[model samples]
Target: MRDHLPPGLPPDPFADDPSDPSAALDSIEPAQPLDAAERLAVEEDLADLAVYEALLARRGVRGLVVVCDDCQQDHYHDWDMLRANLLQLLVEGTVRPHEPAVDPSPDAYVTWEYCRGYADAMMNVVEDD
Candidate 1:
């Protein structure tokens, strides 16, 4: 039976033992806990997200577009989708699956940095008045 498996793949020690107590343990993975700093960052992102949505949506902006580091591509997320993602991260401490907006127009979405700059400029204008 060992020869039937591909090279370097360990044969399951409990494959023949249906009642083995450790058999279930092999399939269970522990949930990773987030550190204090990571938790705080997620909270901050969620708060900033709400403000960004309100401020940008008023200027005919549909939503924010972010560049995926893993895939090296831009993903457009609608306002609700962004909220859900942030909330999920805040609550579950894990990143949900990526769900890019459907056929979003390039003109309607802006990068997070752009949104931050816009917010900063608006704040400065308000302070100057």
Candidate 2:
């Protein structure tokens, strides 16, 4: 048995474990930058969202006030809910179908119009191709 082993080697650290040892460590590269127009739109979106988040944090605004584009009414969503909605829209290119009633819970959400306006302002500033 001694002669069968190789030199300058160590036993497997997790030989008894089923998982890959390297799974505990991983590295990722930074995301690629957006193009000029894309960069501006993204920056604008981020800036507006940041402000909304800050408002939520500082003013204890509870939830943002947003106007719905589909139904022409206000839809209220809390931070978690609003985040979920934003992520959903980002993935799907459109918001969920339903429109919540106006005058939602005191801390539910803001109108979509505000989000659109904020995003639009950024887009508007960009030079047309």
Candidate 3:
């Protein structure tokens, strides 16, 4: 192969060879600064997380396991981890790296939608009573 790459350009491993099996890694940028309204919303979410932890942990709910759209796999975050992430966003305007639960059981984790629905149902029951 003739050297066509620019002076300082690193050659693409698969430039001419098409069977390298290397996946392109996506570059993740830092989160943008939160506006006043967004800041308020994050604060509210943080408060709601506290309530969720209090109510759900008693029911044996460990935490949430999210299937990241980017990674296309499940990531487990315990209640404390979720709280820390939200707090970091509010304070630093950026999320820290994923710190998933260690050897988390898929059975112990619930989706965010499930938690929302559960909370809604509980609220309705409380209102009815």
Candidate 4:
């Protein structure tokens, strides 16, 4: 039988990878749980989100609407719901097991333009005051 081996073959993909499972685990980055500062920052952001949510709610709005970067759709997620989604995304790399729709009133959900205008109006009022 004649040999059909190539003179020079490409390197194997798993050649560098550890063969022993223990060694492989050693190379893997242990899930360093979120640091205290990171957790606090995330919580702070959540709190700010609650403020935005409250503003919307105060105007008879049910929830804050956001455009999904992945879906590119205007998703109406409320304060806690959005927080939950964000947490899930952080943990699972996505909002898996997807949540049921908790649609906020469309009329209540204002655009960024409206919020900015409202802020400007408030600023004007404050300056006058």
Candidate 5:
């Protein structure tokens, strides 16, 4: 049966093994390149991240808290890590998996909406002054 397998398809190395490690892993399709609109959106996110980091970091804000779709849990990312992840996504078309911060303080991280609101409020205050 293995000999008759289709061309270009490698024979499974663990066909006879009952404990194949990959058996439980889902096959992931290759990442597709970002379209123009997607690229623009990512660029905008990067810009917003820069401003958010600059404005919030001074006030003891550690980073952003993002909810993970895969795990359905909150993940805390520091400013530098978030920046690097965004850059990697822009260049590689995929974000690399990373371990979340160890025992991060929930109060130190804010959501994107909070950052946006804070930035807007800061702008208004500046304008008022």
Candidate 6:
């Protein structure tokens, strides 16, 4: 059979396999590099994440709960996972899929806005002291 693979691309190992998992997936385009503003935004998020983790972790907060737009559901990400995802976006221009925390306690996670407000309040208290 004639090879239809693109130049420099390896032959598909699952070409003749009936159970090829990728056969069900549409081809995904390469992720675009972050623009200057996007890069800045991600950097700021990373900095804020560090502050949030430092302040909240000691208070028994596990992590932040984000509302996923694609799935329209709440996704709980621990501090480590959040940092890893942000770093991945900075380095690879894409975030690898991560499994949500298993049986996460909703009460232990706060929204990003809550974190920001908490941080701001804490900063004000520190300045006033």
**Highest TM-score: which candidate?**
6
Runs of candidate 4 with Cα error greater than 4 angstroms are 1-41, 86-97, 100-104, 111-124
- Tens digits of per-residue lDDT, candidate 5, 5-88, equal 323233556666889776564477757888899889999999999999999999999999999998899999888888877776
- Of 4 and 6, the candidate ahead on lDDT is 6
TM-score, each model?
A: 0.72, 0.40, 0.70, 0.47, 0.77, 0.79
**Candidate 6 residue-wise lDDT, 33-75, digit = tens:** 9999999999999999999999999999988999998999999
Better of 1 and 4 by TM-score: 1
lDDT of 1 at 52: 85
After superposing candidate 3 on the true structure, give the runs of residues whose Cα lies further than 4 Å from its correct spot.
Answer: 1-32
Model 4 agreement with the true structure over 1-129: per-residue lDDT tens digits: 222222222223344456733454456554555666766666765665665565556767555566777789787655566676556444534343334345446676665456556656767898999
lDDT of all predictions, in order shown? Answer: 0.73, 0.51, 0.74, 0.56, 0.83, 0.83
Off by over 4 Å in 2: 1-43, 98-103, 106-129
**What's the count of clashing pairs in each model shown?**
0, 12, 0, 0, 0, 0
Which tens-of-lDDT digit does each residue in 19-105 have in candidate 2?
855544335343344456754664565456666666444556555666656677556655554555454444434333333445556
Looking at model 1, residue 78 earns an lDDT score of: 75
lDDT of 3 by residue, 1-129 (tens): 445432222345565565754433325565688999989999988888877877789988888888887889899888877886787788768764544566888887888788878888999999999
Candidate 2 has its poorest 10 consecutive residues by lDDT at 1-10
Best first by lDDT, ranked: 6, 5, 3, 1, 4, 2
- Candidate 1: regions farther than 4 A off: 1-31
Q: Which ten residues in a row have the lowest lDDT in candidate 4?
A: 1-10
Q: What would you estimate as the lDDT of candidate 1? A: 0.73
Cα RMSD to the true fold for all candidates: 12.7, 16.9, 12.4, 17.3, 10.5, 8.6
Structure candidate 5, residue pairs in collision: none
Task: Give the true-structure RMSD of model 4.
Answer: 17.3
